[model samples]
Target chain A: MFEKKRLHPISIISHIAKQLIDTLFPLLVLVVMKARTVSLGWNIAVPTVVLLYTTLIGFFTWLRFTYQLNERELCIEQGVFLRKKRSIPFERIQGISISAGFFQRLVGVVQVRIETAGNELGKAEAILTAVTKKEAEQIARQIRKVKEGVVHDETIELINRSEQPNDIVFSLRFRDVFLLSVTSGGVFGVLAAIAAFISQLDDFISYDALYRKVQALGFVRNTLSGVVAIFVLFVVAYAISVGRHLLRYAFFTVRKQEDMIVISRGLFEKQLLTVSRKRVQGIIIKENVVQRLLGYVSVHIIHAGGSLDGGESGSVVFCPFMKKERAASVIAACLPEYHIHHEFQALPQRARVRYMLRPVYVFAIPIGMVAYVLRPWGMGLLLLLPIVSYLGYKSYQMAGWAISANQLALRSGMFRIQTIYMLKYRIQSVATSATWLQKRKQLSTLAVAVMPKMFSKVTDVDEKEAEAVYTWMQ
Target chain B: MAQLSKRISERAVSVWRIYALIRFTIFLLVYIIVCFLLMKFDGPKWVVFLLAVLFLADLFLFVLLWPRWRWQRWRYDVREQEIEIEHGVWIIKRTLIPMSRVQHVDLKQGPLLKKYKLASITIFTAATVHEIPALDEQEAEKLRHVISAFVKVDDRDV
Candidate 1:
C-alpha cells in the first residue's frame, strides 16, 4: 500500500541545521580547545566522532525519506538503514493545517500538519515540511474529502472540486487594528522599551564617557535630552506593536466548510486551518475594558486536537473588533446548538457572601502572623486583606453553571471570563463536593471531567449553586 | 434460562474495631516522632507542651469517633435500569450509575472476610465508581452476576 517518492533535497539542509543547533554547545567547546592548542586526545576524538556521526545521519536521512499519497491513505517511508513506514487511513484523518514562517515563505514552501482525534500526546499524526503552497492546498482538499466521506458514510469522490469557503464571518480593518493595539497593552510595551533603552546606554556609548558628557551638560539640556529619549522609545514600541499586529492579522478570514470552519490569514507565512464542527467545545467572545467601551469583541473557538504546536495553538480570532450583536449572530450561525441568552444566571447573594468570607477567614491567621513579624513593613501587607477580599467577591460573582439539553456550560474567572462547554456524552465523570460551611448552607461545588486534546483533564465550578444542578441532573 | 440466588450472612463489628485500632496505633507513632524532634531541637518548652496537648486532644477525638468511622453502613439498590449507592458519615453522598455505563463488576474477599464468609463488591463505570463493602459471600456473588448481565445488555435504552 506504499509507493516511494524522494522528499525535496532541501529537507536535508533543514535536518542538518536542526542537528547543528543541538550540537552547538559541544562544537563551541571543541573550537575553543583547538584554538588554545590544547591537544587532549579524548576531547578531539569526541568532537571528531560527533561530526562524522551528524554528517552520516544527514546523508542517510536524504536517502531514506519518501512520502506517497494513494486514493485511500497517505504513507510516509523514512529511516536511515532500517525503513519505517507510517500509514494514515483516509477515514481517521481529522484536519489539515498549513503554516509558513518568513524563511519558508521566501523559499515558496509551507509546513503541512495532519491532525487526528483521540489521545493527548502527539495528536498531530504527521507533519510535512517545505511543500509548495499549491501542493499543500491540494493535499488538504484531498484529506478533507476523505474526512467528509467518513462523517457522511460515503466513498471518496474522484472529482477535484476546488473547495471554496462559504463566507467571511469576521474581519478587522486597519482602523480597528490600530485602536485595539493602542488601547490594549500598548502602554506596558512602551514602558518596557524605555527601560530597555536606558539599560543599553553603556552598550551604545562608554559608561564613563556618557557620565562625563552628562556632567558637562547644563540641567536644562540634560532634562531635554531625557524627554527626547522617552519620546523616541514610546514611538518605537507603539510602532512595533501596531506593525506586528497588522502583519500577523492583515487579511484574517474565517469561512465555513461542509462540517468544519477554515481560518486563513497573514501576508507572509500564511496559515490555513480547519476544525471539525463537532470538535468545537465552546466559543469565547472577549472584549477588553477598552474594547468594551468602544463596542468591539474578539471571538475565539475552543476545539479539541486543533492546536498547531500542541498547547492552546488553534485559537483563531474570528473577528478582531466587531459589534457585539454582529459577533453573536455569526457565532449562532456557526454553532446553532448554542443559543446566546441575554440574561446570564448569577449565584444567589447569600452564596456570594459565604464564598467571599471563606477565603478571608482562611487567610486571616497567616496574614495576622506576617503583620506581627514585619512591624512597620507589616502595614503595607495589611493592604492585601482588601485585595484578597475583593478578588474573592468578584470570583463569587463571576462563577455560574448552566445546563442545556445537550450541553453543560461552566463560567469562571473574574477579570477574564472563561465559559467552558462540554457535550453531555463527552463528560467522563461528574464529582460534587461540599466543605463544612458549604454543607451548612446546602451549597456544593461540581467538577466535570473532559478529555481535552492537551493539558488539564478537568474544568470545574467551585462554590456555585450545586444542589439545584444535582437535583436537575438526577 | 434459569436464575440463581444467593444470600449473604452478616459479620461481627469486631472486624471494623480491629481496623480502627491499627490506624490509631500508626497515628500515635507518627505523633511521638514529631514530638521527639521538637523537644530535641531546643524548641520553647511552652510551645512543645501546647503541641503535646493538641496531639492528645486529637487522639481523644479520634478514639471517640472510632465507632462512627468503623460503622458498617452501605446501601446498594439495583433497579431495572440503574445502580444506586448511598454512603458516608457526617455528610451522606448518593450516586446513581445507569446500567448502560457499568463496564464491569468485581467480587473480592480478603483473609478476614473469607474467614467470616463475607465479600466486597465494586462496580466499575466509565465515569463514576461505586463500592459495597462487608457483604456476605452469597450476596456478593449474586450482585456481581446481575451487574455483569446488565453490563452486557445493549446500552441503546440508556
Candidate 2:
C-alpha cells in the first residue's frame, strides 16, 4: 500500500542544523556552569559526552531517514536505534504544502509537506526536504492523481469556468508589498534585538546598566534619541519584511486543479498550497482602516483543520494587498461554493448600545478607583475616559454578523476588519447566555465552539446576534 | 431496546441533592477552620465573625434551594442526522450535535453510583462536553450501545 523513496542529501545538513539549534541552549548552559566551577576535568568530560551524544543522534538520523511514494501510500522511515515507519494512505491524504526559509531558498530547494486528515498538529505525515520546484509539483500531482483519480493535463492552466465573464486576477506589486511591510507591527524587530542583547550578555554590560545609561541622557536628548532610534528600527524592519515578502511571493500564480485551487509562489523558497473546494470553510476579505481607505483588501481562506503555525501569532499573510473587487472575483472563481453576497448588515442600534455600554461599565469601576487614588498627582489623567469610550464605541460600530444560505459570517476588530466564516456542519456546539441586564433588554450572548486548529478555540460572533443565530440554527 | 427518548431516571434529583449538600457541608467546615485559625493568630475579630456568618448563610441557602439546584431538566431529540440537548437551570442551554461529529459515547459509574446501580452517560462531540447523569445501569448501557451503533453507521454513510 505504501512505497519508499530516499530524501534529498541536503536534508542531512538541515536536520543537523535543526538538532543543533534545539540542543544549543542547554549545551551552552552546561558549558557556562562548568566554566564558573573551574573544574577542567568535569568540564571536559561533560562536554565530551554531550558532543558524542549529539553527534551519534545526528548521524543515526541521517542514516535512518528515508521517504517513499507509490500509487496507494506515502511512507517515511526514520528513527535512531529504534527504527519507525509512518505510512499515509493515498486516499486519506488531504493536501501538499510547501514552505522554505532564506537558507533553503539560497540552496534552491523547498520543503514539501504532505497533510492528511484527522491529525491537526505536528509535521505533515511526510516531508520532502530540498526538492526542486518541478520535482515538488510532480510529486504533488502524482499524489493528487492517485488520491482523487483526476489527471490534470497542464502543469499550470487558467480556466474560465464561471457563468460570469472572467477577469484578470490581481497580484501584489512591489510598491504595495513595501507599504504593507512598513505598516506591519515591528514586535518581531524588538524581540530580535532583545534576543541578540541577551545572547551577548557576557561580553556586554547588563540590561539594567544600559537602561540607566539611556535614562541619564536627560529629557530632550533622550526624546530625540528615542525618536531617531524608532525611525531607524522601523526602516530596517520594513525593509526586511518587504524583502522577505518579495522573495516568498515574487512569482505568485493561482490555478485550478479539478475541484481544488492551487496557489504557487516564491522566487527562491517556493511554496505550493492546494485547498480542496469542499474544505475551504470561507473566504475572508479583510482590510485595515488604512488599507480600506487605500481601496485594498487582503484575501485569506478559513480552513477547518489547518492553521498557520505559531498559533496565529505570526503574520504569514496571504495576498498581502489586493483591490476589493478583484479579491471578491478571485474568491468567487476559486471557490464557487463559498461565494457570499457582499451586503453586510449592521447590528441593531439597541444591540450596539448594549455592546458599547458593557465594556465601559466593566472597566469604569476599576479605572475610576485607580484614578481617584492617584488624584494627588493630577486630574489630567482622568482625560483617558473619553478616549476609552471612543474606542469602545468604534468597536461596537465595527462589529457585525451576517448569515448566508450555507455560510455564517462575522466581522470584527476596531483597526483591522476581520471576517470569519463557519459552515453549518463544521460547528460542534452552540451555547447562549444572557446577563441580568441583557435579559431585561431581551438580548442574549451566544458562543459556538469549533475544533481549534492550533491551540485556541476559533469562535467568533457578536454575542446577541450569535444567540439569535443559535436559536435559528436549532 | 425500545428507543430511549427521555433523560436519565427520576431518581437523579435526589442523588444530585445529596451531592450538593455534602459539598456545601465540606465548604462550611473549611470556612470555619480557616476563620478559627485566623482568630488564633489575633486577626481582625470583626472580619472573622462576618466571614463565618457569610459561610453559615451560604450553607442555609444551599440546603433550602437543594431541590431547585439538584433538579435534572433535560430534553433530547435524536433525529436521523442530529442530536439536540437542552438542559440547565436559571440559564437554559441547548446544543445540537450532528451524528457525524459524535466521536463516541460512554456509560460510566463511580463508587457512589455503583451502590445505587446507576450510571452516567457522556456524549463526546468534537469540541464540547455533554453529560446525562443518573440513569439506571441497564438504561445507561442501552443508550451507550445505541449511540455507538449510530455513530459508526453515520461514519460509514459519510
Scored by lDDT, model 1 comes in at 0.61
What lDDT is reached at residue A440 by model 2? 63
lDDT of 1 by residue, A54-154 (tens): 87898788787778888778888888878889988877766566676555666767777777653334457877766776666666666667666443121
Off by over 4 Å in 2: A1-6, A15-87, A99-110, A121-123, A131-170, A184-251, A308-318, A358-385, A422-430, A448-468, A471-474, B1-74, B88-92, B98-158
Which regions in candidate 1 have their CA more than 4 angstroms from the true location?
Answer: A1-92, A121-123, A132-148, A151-166, A175-250, A266-268, A285-298, A304-322, A358-381, A401-409, A420-431, A449-468, B1-158
- Docking quality tier of model 2: acceptable
Residue A355 error, candidate 1, Å:
3.2
Q: Report the CA-based lDDT of candidate 2 relative to the real structure.
A: 0.61
What DockQ class does candidate 1 belong to?
Answer: incorrect
TM-score of each: 0.62, 0.70
lDDT of 2 by residue, B1-158 (tens): 12225776666666666777888888878888888888799887888778878877766666555445545545565655667766665565556667677888878899878777889988877556678777889988987877777774333211
Q: For model 1, state the Cα shift of residue A283 in Å.
A: 3.6
With candidate 1 superimposed using the best TM-score fit, by how many Å does residue B3's alpha carbon deviate from the native? 29
